[model samples]
Target chain A: MPQPLRYLQIFATFARNSLIRDMTFRANFLIEFISSLSWVFMNLGFYILIFHYTPSLGRDTGWGKYEFFVFTGTALMINSLAGMLFMTNADNFGELIRRGGLDFVLVKPVDTQFLVSLQRVDWSSSGNFLVGLGLAVYSLRCLGVWPSPVTIVLYVFYLLCGVVILYSLMFLLAATAVWLGRNETLFDFWFYIVSFGRYPMEIYEGRFGRPFRWFFTFIIPVLVAINVPSRFLVQSIRPQSLEEWLLPLYTIAATVIVFAVCRAVFQLALHSYRSASS
Target chain B: MAAIEIRGLSKTYRVTRKKEGLVATLRALFRPEYEYVHAVRSIDLTIESGEFVAFLGPNGAGKTTTLKLLSGIITPTSGEARVLGHIPWRRENAYRRRFALVMGQKNQLWWDLPAAESFHLHQQIYGIPPDQFTRVRDELTEMLGVRQLLHRPVRELSLGERMKMELVAALLHSPQVLFLDEPTIGLDVVAQYTIQQFLREYQARTGTTVILTSHYMKDVVVLCRRVVVIFDGQIIYDGSLTNLVDHLGDYKIITIRFSDGQVPTDLSRFGKIILREPPRVRLRVARNEATEVIRAVLARYIAEDVSVEDPPLEELIAALFASARNSRLSQERGNSAVPEDTTHSANH
Candidate 1:
């Protein structure tokens, strides 16, 4: 039908084929799925132990047990989206370049970036995503905060924004593999950067924290990713100032800018690509 | 119009050089040495549409590099090329849809998925209509005799069966031009013959321009009429295969079997003696002198059997490269005569 619809259809086919491939190694898939979910549960347990002694993350920062759990859930959701969609492909991008697998990708009639970024679907990562959703609903219920449908819709919108930001950052890191030849440290670096978003932004409010907060909030924008969406759910609990209400707009703008810049970087890397000799 | 054209096309890569040993490896991590490798030098050529041409070369002889440049897999270091009226490196979708590059050592199909699944993916990627996809896929699989293997995972198939499936995947789009880089490599004689027969029939039916790079001489002799030989990143010869044999192969091989009890004392006047057995002798005679040499041998000896034939293409090609190397060495030495020792080294 239409071009965009055709691409979506192709993406669906890729997802279907990936699932079939995964089914071929069903035992390994189950192991990975269980391991991923275990990590989510372990994190939840660690935070529950912390909430045992502290009333809030910061004395006056309004981050109580349920509020912080909401933030944790939002971070997990964003990370899982990225992990499912781009992690496997990005991790394999270096090998593809090194072993000349990208030559086949470059010759395809579809968009190179689109195909490379979305070719593999990690269905196992969705386990963490479902767990994250459950935590978010559980925390919302614990807070006795029944969000309106509009608030829930806004939460989903901002959750997508968070995923887009994470994807752009991960993609940009993966694109560097073209020049670096091999970047095995990319996942380590990605986890380090994303760990900052796992907690409430209020944790970074002191002397050294001020600049860290400002840098992540404005430059990398990871702080805003989970903060805005988690805050959208508890808007009544912590009423928003004008600037707080404008966070969604800022998230949109950041997503557009980061997406465009990363896309350009990826294209420039592809232009400089000297394929491995056969 | 020519389906493919190239002038001064080249590719140079900056290769990192590292020394052996742990200390040097550690030092290289801080500061690595670099050298420029000219994979393909200035080369000029053109091929008409629907022409099947063989690109023959030894290892590291720039055959694959030229194909990558023409297929838009990699950009050139300098110069220009146009395929089907479009610069290949520009990589417009329309251009890509009309051409296919199949590398024997690399695969596009997913390892865990069935070949049929990959075919469907190609149909989507190329935006092929369902009917056209099915017809082309069935025709190719049927021709290659691989219809039964399409539903099995690609990893489980043998190399020859996998290669046939790869060909089917590449050709399902009905590309107007096909670039095959060593398609029949590492295959048994029967498998190679099967691929060759299918290629010949496919070329005849569709008139697609095919440029194949193969180490197998039989693939070239059976499928392509024209051949381009490359050495040291340059085009050394380009003409019909028959012309290649005529131009470089100037001698014929003559084998003579004498009656059991008879032996010729001297046959030097007839030709250069290549082999000598008690009752049989082989000689390399100049093409023009072959008839006269045979006449003289028959007159001088009682022959039970006699056979005269052109040397195999493999020998002709080895001789061509050895001679080319010899000339290059002589030119480097600033002499008109090749050293006798160097000739032995070249032959080996």
Candidate 2:
């Protein structure tokens, strides 16, 4: 079989198995879905309260209440999809290292990164994904914007780029657990970094915010992930600057670079894994 | 060609050292101490295809480390090893597909899903053809008597049942070489025997080269004709299991049943009194002195029956380990018989 076909087959099996596993614990699975949806709702409610006081998120940022909603929805979709696919696997990578579970993975005739990253899907995050999709469409409708077919295509493609970026970043962090031995702080650091991507890059324009924006935009590329994709979908808004217009291309470049770097680091870490003795 | 050929293969781990007490903890937080542990000292070994070899050692003697190195789970600090014509640490996909490693303490199957689900996942991961996968899976499940438990969640199965499933998963790929690290750890006697029987029969049928590291002497005795005894990361003895006994077994057991149901009063004069019941007494006599001791015992008392036999394999192995420790200790100290204080465990 071709390599891609083989991997796709394995991934399909993994997804099916994960769904079965989730259904096996119906109560816990339902509770997780409810919990994720509740968190999204509360976040949306918080933004709604903020919009009531101010017409836009920031002064002259062009991100009106509904426009900002689009950005938030894009972020939600990106995070939800990434979390559903890679969150549990990345979080468990550390435990795998500590418990020597990775030994089995190393012996399998498959790409270690692919196996480690996509082995388990968090089905609960599907609820959050739906909520994000609803919010994006509802906000687009409220803004009275109908994007062109090209814009919609670009938006979907960039959303995938956004997901890949987050997966790469999370995988990079989890791979560090191999050397650190125990990286319980991985999610803590990830949460902090991802929080920067939640809001629009416009909010970061002041003396202190400029460098933060530059760091997150060009260096980490988290800002461009959701911002560019959401910008493409919100037809009423147009790129205000050359840099903003080129953000989509930059996001694509960043995804490729980040994923390649993650693969390299994960391989290096695997070489250093001292499998725990039985 | 040799299924495995290891030359001076070694693995050294750099471990952090922390002292006890709050002050030491604080000090370590600032300036941590570190030391190197030689998990596998430079050792050379070779095994041909279809050979079943047992790596016997106390805990931390580098048996599992060697297995991991062979399976390509971890790279060695130094030296070289090739499994099936591939350098293991290179981790080529072709090499990985041709071998499997199973650790009894760690599970590869999904905990929340049925074993059948994991088996199907394995079929996809290994890219096994549908017909071949079904045939192999059925054969393994039927042989292990786990066909009924395939649909049950793995967590719901007993330890023995779970281990049987693990074997099926490992064998589904039809690996040319199998590495088993304490595959029967933490199991009842019945379970252990069942697994041992399955492995023996499977090896016989498939002719796959297998290297197993097990603390259970029974596992070693029952499955392996070739045994390698390692101590302190070095191979101390390697040969047939029968030869291991012949080389280190210095004592025999003598059992004497008295005509009257009365215990011998001075049995120690002959040899170590291993057992002393009212009617029968067992003695551990030097192998060379068995004849004289038996003659002395028969003349000294009215015996109903007498028998002689080799000591249990466990005792011989324990004595071998004890003698090796003594010799090492004696060499370590300026004295001729300085023994290191490190613990040596024979879990069996």
Candidate 2 lDDT over B106-210, as tens digits, reads 898999889999999899888999999999999999999999999999999999999999999999999999999999999999999999999999999999999
Best by TM-score: 2
Candidate 1 interface CA RMSD, Å: 0.7
Clashing pairs in 1: none
**Poorest lDDT segment (10 consecutive residues) of candidate 1 chain B:** B339-348
Which fraction of the native contacts appears in each prediction?
Answer: 0.71, 0.91
* Regions of candidate 1 where Cα sits further than 4 Å from its true position: A236-243, B21-31, B259-269, B276-280, B329-348
TM-score of chain A of each: 0.96, 0.97
Q: Tell how far residue B347 is off in model 1, in angstroms.
A: 27
Q: Return the DockQ of model 1.
A: 0.79
TM accuracy, model 2: 0.95
RMSD of each: 4.1, 3.4
| Docking quality tier of model 1 | medium
Taking the tens digit of each residue's C-alpha lDDT, what string does model 1 give over B208-309? Answer: 999999999999999999999997678999999999999888999999999965668788678888888868888999999999998988887789999999
Each prediction's whole-model lDDT (CA):
0.88, 0.89
Q: Which regions of candidate 2 fall more than 4 Å away from where they truly are?
A: A235-237, B334-348
